[model samples]
Target: MPRHDGGEKPQRSCLACRETRDRDRLIRFVLSPQGEVVPDLDAKLPGRGAYTCIDAACLAAAVKQRQFGRAFKREVAVPTPDEMTAQVAKLLLERVMGYIALANKAGKIVAGGSMVGDALKSKNKPGLVLVARDVSEAIGEKIAAQAAGNNVPCRWVLTKDDFGALLGKAPRSAIGIKSSGFVVQLLKTIERYRNFLGEVQ
Candidate 1:
């Protein structure tokens, strides 16, 4: 664990890349009593923890070099590279989904196609536009164009069913996120997810 300065969160080095970053930006792993490497996504587990950037390439390098044993300073059972990647990806996706749900609950999200379009056109523009993956190309393009015109970030990753479920609606083709502190956190989580999947440079 890296030492904290004042009230700032501690920084930790990636076991593979060895690059120091805020602990929240890295994934944490702990050695269980059974010697199994367990992901402590919340970083609340009671044990010595190893850190790794939330990236597939970094994870691959760590697995290839068998760094877990060295990090834990003991013989630990590490999952296969594929399994590890899948597990991490699953956890990240769940987190992103949870954030979307929270934004909706907090009245920070405007769902439904027309509502989102209007929100984008309003003088009080949203900070982000989320289009469902399965949305028609015409609608998606329109939303993207509107967002671009307003200098707002646009993302199309979740399916209609996924977005709808998060918003507690039947199904939505588009949604708008109001500019707020939560939007910043949501965007950061999305970027981390993209990095983990190698979807962005």
Candidate 2:
């Protein structure tokens, strides 16, 4: 599985901007059997690989300037910028959700509103506070405030129903991740997605 982390990462130059960045900061691409360019989100695809900054304009620049053809050393079909960007965003979002599930299974997740609130106030604070979108407005605001007071990152992600479905349990209004590994990677990936979408993190 691919991940975003604070630790030193593999660096590569973007085929579009020709700028060097961490591997997690760029999206990877590879040539397909049918002579077309495809995104290798996992970075596990075989053969030579191309990289691009996670920006729509950069992707467009690559297509317009024939960067892919030059890098791959052959002609290859590439999707329109809009199509490619959408696909990247979709894959990134899926990775985020998958991490949440893995964390829960690893027993690093603290679920339920009361438990999450208590965890935030304890000496051993959680790495992150995740508030379901469907949580009660008052409860959400309170938890958000608590997290802010504790200098914790509070991200409103999937709804209560969705969280429940993913964890195979009853609805969860709020949750906390206790593992440092999960927190760093989740924060990095969340920021990456937000940056790619031109949203302030």
Candidate 3:
């Protein structure tokens, strides 16, 4: 499809929505050697790729309408709607976790509620505040208020245990990303995740 903005970025039309958008905004799927439809999150699997918006509704529509079959011009093997949704969600979550690990290794993230609160108050405020889903209500509220006061965007996803596992430490209630690049990348993945679940985020 032609670029909607006449820009350099490659665009693909969603097989379900039929709306053209930047390729990155669409999830790419390709046929595996065994003929199963597989999501290529990295867009690197070699084959004619199919596209869909990062949304459960769009995915369902595509599956219901046999859009993938038409796209491939053959009987492409696709999972049931529920299985496909779960598979795509798992892939997106993995990518989010990978970015978290990379950001932590680069020293762009600081964990613990107190540390994150401090970072929000520092001269170099954090680009984003990430709270644990299992955070204590009191501290969670405090940290959220601090992030708001600092005008930092706050997010909630994984639990304290998930944070600890990734950071190689004890459980943490929160973390702050100070690097803009990492913040941008994390938010992009999070947004896709939110869209998939139709969540407010």
Per-model TM values vs. the true structure: 0.87, 0.79, 0.91
Arranged by TM-score, best first:
3, 1, 2
Model 3 TM-score (2 dp): 0.91
Stretches of candidate 1 off by over 4 Å are 1-10
What do the candidate models score in CA lDDT, each in turn? 0.88, 0.84, 0.88
**Candidate 3: regions farther than 4 A off:** 3-8
Task: Please name the candidate that would achieve the greatest TM-score relative to the true structure.
Answer: 3
- Candidate 2 Cα errors over 4 Å, as ranges: 1-11, 60-66, 133-138
Assess candidate 1 and give its lDDT. 0.88
lDDT of 2 at 58: 78
The sequence of per-residue lDDT tens digits that candidate 1 reaches over residues 52-81 is: 998988987897799999988889998998
For residues 142-192, could you state the per-residue lDDT of candidate 2 as single tens digits? Answer: 999999999999988778987787788899999899957999888877776
Candidate 3 residue lDDT tens string, 36-131: 889998899999999999888899789888899999988888998888999999888888788888999999888999999878878998898889
